[model samples]
Target: MTESAPTPQPDGLDVYVITYDEEGHEERLLPSEVTDAVVERSRDFGINKGSWTIDRIKHGPLIAAESQLRLVNVGSLARAIAGNYYGTALIVDQTPPPIDEDVYDIDRRYDVDVVDDVLVAVVTQRHPAQPAETEAEIAARLARIAAAYGCRIVGVSFALPGGGTPEEMLSHWPEGEEWSERFRAETIETLAGMAHDVKVSIATDDNVTMATLMDGAAAMADYLSATQTGPLDAAGVLNLLRGGHFNLLIGEAESGYLEVKTQMHPISAPGDTGKKAKVELAQDVARFANGDVDAVLVIGYKEAPGGANTIGSLTPVADSILNTAQIHELLDARIVPPVDGLIIEKFVVTATDSVLAIYVPKQPSEMQPYLVHGAIAEGKVEGAFFSIVRRRGEGSITTSAQQIHAYIVAGKRYLRGND
Candidate 1:
């Protein structure tokens, strides 16, 4: 067979040379274009008149311009390329900007130039009349932006108008300089409430550049994707609660395996003296068990008018509105084919605010299609026999006859050693 022409390969470094004009417009170039530009620029600068060649380095591509000067700094050459050609190069791995670094010096000019790996959102205080944006608003905006790029917010930092360097701000906060203690405390509180285990920092114009934020957000998205373990176990969920990542948990929207409720069902237990609460709890558990994945029910998170659920006041849990053990006992009594690894825990968020989380793990194939027996008011099936309830996006619904049949067939296959 005749040999085919060797296919051209892309530049191994995967670097982009971006050149900006005096008008602040940008032009991106490939590795070859960058090499030609550097050679021509070096000749123009009178630093190197000899021939030049491109050398491939493990880190990235390098322009080796032959020069008579004995002491030539490569860093200086790189800087010249950027300044003279009005172009800068970026490597995917290196040159990524560091978060929480000072961007400007005392003169308020660009000092260090680097690419960023995270999303640095700069919340500037414009006109005082503008409504004060809440943490929720910021988070919602971030969610929309991140979703467009298939990423998530990993960190958030703030920049106040006339806020000095990060170091100055830190020292000033302690001394109560310029701004009052209450103002400083409120700023920190607001940031802490939104950070959700992500790193939050005070940054100057020198460090909190748009480039840095974008790079930081990218790095964060990678980290989250790698470390994520969906549907945490009871212990893992508890760790998130105590570790101040509760905001992160609540930030997530309802999905197949997650559900949020304003309060426990039946609202009242002793005074009402009915099985409504028990039945409702059982239905919830049964619905989760019938689904393909585990589920987490977050109580005390009420849905607002705009479909945003916030951590509402937990007077019920605080006032002993519902007992955890009792709820578990009731679920056991009502749900047939007992749910294994069902965990119900109460966490005291504040003195008067508390919340309950119930984790229902997916049962084995042999125990599929868990059913509810008693009449559950507002449930998918009321006064029905052997009702298999399945959870949809955010609500529970009665499983269709086709779905029930598929579940039975799968269970039979497992029993027959076919699955």
Candidate 2:
């Protein structure tokens, strides 16, 4: 945590990234890599050039904004100011405010958490005793943070006396018209590429916004339950993978693009287990390859036997339990044409325990409907069979014969007079 990042170079807006993993593993799990924080300049926005974290943007102090952020040419402000209507100035020419490190840390200002794989960071500076916040300051902080973290989505929520929907919340705002029609959208547009999406959600009618006063998790649950409750999208799935949010892969249920297995295939052992393992691996990879985005298959998680198939409990296996070479060999031997860009990685949870992860990236249209070369039947192996499986939400299903016939007919029509 005390590791120092590269110092900022002259003439470029400096950015820093934190290289810490906050996963609450029983033992301080040793991350395979340790990338130190570094400061670098960007073309216009920081997101495009450097990988950054929110914590450093808000907490660390700066010489010329060595600690704080100075946002320029953002949103309508870009039109309000210069360069392109979207990028910041090339130089760090603004004078930054001074701060006390001890006070910033000891004083109650902000708190951060990881909720369901999403970063839930809150600014707590509404009291009279504490100094007032600057105009759109909270927002600027987030832009820098998300850019550094390379977050796909970023959100901020304010709980007022009568907060509700975005419209209702706007109506209650002192300067709703000025904020929504211009400023808010400007901030979002200004920080566009830093995080793929950035928007604010309103949560009022309760005191849950007081994160310091109550349980942060409870406050988060209450604040968000009202605003969003939709299914996981590609961005959400990506966040779950990138963030140290391994809760689901090891101890939770399945969702779109994620499949969990309690044990790896006994491909090395004698008997039908090895053969069945090959079929299972090939089907799993094929199904994910047939989807819209990259997917993950986590081995070493105990899933429910039937019905809902809820995943629970960690069953981290030895490194010898699953071999990446064997998996690649099995897929090539069983799936037709084989899926490309597969990332098979093993993460050590502790000294002796680890989990295996298989990342199946999205395939091209020419490789549509990847097929498994084998199948399992009557407690035996059927090596000559081929099957097409697709993933729908948390479950996988076989493609129907009707769809297959339609594809063949379409192909025949395309080749009309050749026959």
Candidate 3:
């Protein structure tokens, strides 16, 4: 038989051995020839408990490894070669690794892993920290970090002890209030505009592991990207609350775009009493319709002593009193030149306590001066026909003769396209 040249042995591969000590010190071994003996020795050198858990064996340019081996059972071979020192190994190869590849496969194959391709940035908040940072500040910092890494934020999750429900965890805040819930909701809302995926999770233990958080974030990012479209839903509102933006409604004064109501007119039954309450609701809507910008009417928050608005008792409107349908019907029926973009939502704080938020969007300039058609109060002249304009820092004031003149002048300027 003709003598055949022995199959050329593949180029030597580089094997790196990394070890970690109990003191958390890391030592990386020099690159050595890839051989069963060298790999076995490396495993022996990196066999400490800490190294076994923390050290990762990574390999790349897998073409050389494949050329050298007859049958490349990458994962098993790597673990067997490393022996007891086998930790997490990553294989870097142009070809995709098997779907069942383990962390040890990092050393055995070259493939693109979703975990590696998608960078996860985690921003953590710990309780009992001094001089707490505001949600805005925290969000800004996270944004900058994500930008630096060119990665999208996946979600916002809370790490709490015992991993209780959001409500249960929030109860730990002072007075067992829902400040934590609101904070979480608000943070989610703020991040929602930036990243599609946002969520909240309670840690199973006191220790919040980055690995667990990254997993959750990845899942949430996938979900948000796949399922959600347009703006956020009720969950988004909760996120808004958690973000602390609701504090704006509770602060010292209401802006022209904001209104706070301690309570709504009680609705006993669907009769004259209910009609009166509906008409009253319409009046509030009309007031905002005439304003220059969108308005937010927050019911259940009342002005307390020292001008601070506090969340008031929710006894005014019974749980069965107003549904979304009734609120919409009332607005459609009572307000003349019906306001567009009015969103009425009810937020239940507790079993016996709840609040209603009426969002009134600004109407066109021609639609200004919206008037309440049916008067709730029979004798009061003010209730029959009125144009209420919100003055900054000042409470809602009825349109005065001077103000009307200014409105006419402004209207003329807008119409003529000149001041």
Candidate 4:
């Protein structure tokens, strides 16, 4: 538990991501040699970038960002800040979109669970080449879904960068006034209902073709940065609005490029291929335990068959860890077992003084029923007897000598008592 994540701050913020995208798990679960290597490399990058994120958060008022853009100008600025301030920064992204596509799909995605407690909601609005939905309608839908879940709906907003014509804005934005104003109003309304201080912002670099859009973003960013705590960055600026330090850059850029490449070290086990898998699985178990989750019920391990003397492909243990890591960065305490078909009825888990505790008592009210079996453990049964009143093969009643002696002693005692 001590090694796991620290206690979450109640005052910070709960972020919720809504989208209709689904995470692709096929490559995540099992990868070929090339894909595995890619994963290994990405893991290294994720760790390094994650460290920066932690540092910036711990230090305060620094940007931590990631982007799909090859040359992240905003990331460079954060790096400059860290370089001068003796601080750290986190800038990581799997691709151009720092927010997972599935995480974006509020309609049919589960990644929303990650930000279930978020104090703010940030999204990216792509001014559609053609209009389909209205801003007010979108807001209504968002409110409905959030209220139905009993989750406090703080704000629903998007991060925009500068540059566009008024006609373009009208044609692009659902509301005719301006995208920034419309978004800010909606955000304020949502937050006011939730009884929380809230603000939304947009960002954009000065550009001619997209000047109007950029102006709108800059205006909103300025307002929020002044009145609220949000700031602007090279990325889409959503991360900053989502409570991330406004340092790293997000989104992909065309033409100009600055891609950072790094190598990854493979975790190898000589004559033992299951080591990585085991570590991953254990980490997952540890995280569950840390979160005070009870038992982990595993459907049997999925595996490819092997010959009488060969090892199988894709270790289940490793898969478990990878899956767990995707959900959480750390694990505290959890119960894990290798077997399948495990069930616990209304189990409770608690942690105290760095130790995770689980309690199960053999009370009848809580006991589960079991079918009698032919094989039973010795010493579990108090006694056993068999008798045949009449047998065609001339069988007779049978009892152990010990039982017979006890019966005789009881009969003698009755006789002596003149019963």
Relative to the unseen true structure, what is the C-alpha lDDT of residue 43 in candidate 3, on a scale of 0 to 100?
36
Q: What are the clash counts of all predictions, listed in order?
A: 16, 9, 20, 42
Against the correct fold, how does model 4 do in TM-score? 0.18
lDDT of 2 by residue, 237-336 (tens): 3344343334423324577667778778777777778778778778888888888877778787787666576665667888867677877877877777
User: Which whole-number lDDT from 0 to 100 does residue 172 have in model 4?
Assistant: 40
Give a tens-digit lDDT track for model 1, residues 352-392. 76778888887786676788876544543355555668787
How far is 276's C-alpha from truth in model 4 (Å)? 45
Ten-residue stretch with the least lDDT total in model 4 = 256-265
Q: Which is the leading candidate under TM-score?
A: 2
Residue 297 lDDT in candidate 1: 76
Worst 10 residues of 2 by lDDT: 72-81
Q: After superposition, which runs of candidate 2 have C-alpha atoms over 4 Å from their true positions?
A: 1-244, 248-253, 304-309, 400-405, 417-419
lDDT of 2 at 257: 68
* Every model's TM-score: 0.42, 0.47, 0.40, 0.18
* Residue lDDT tens for model 3, 148-180: 222334434433333433445334444445656
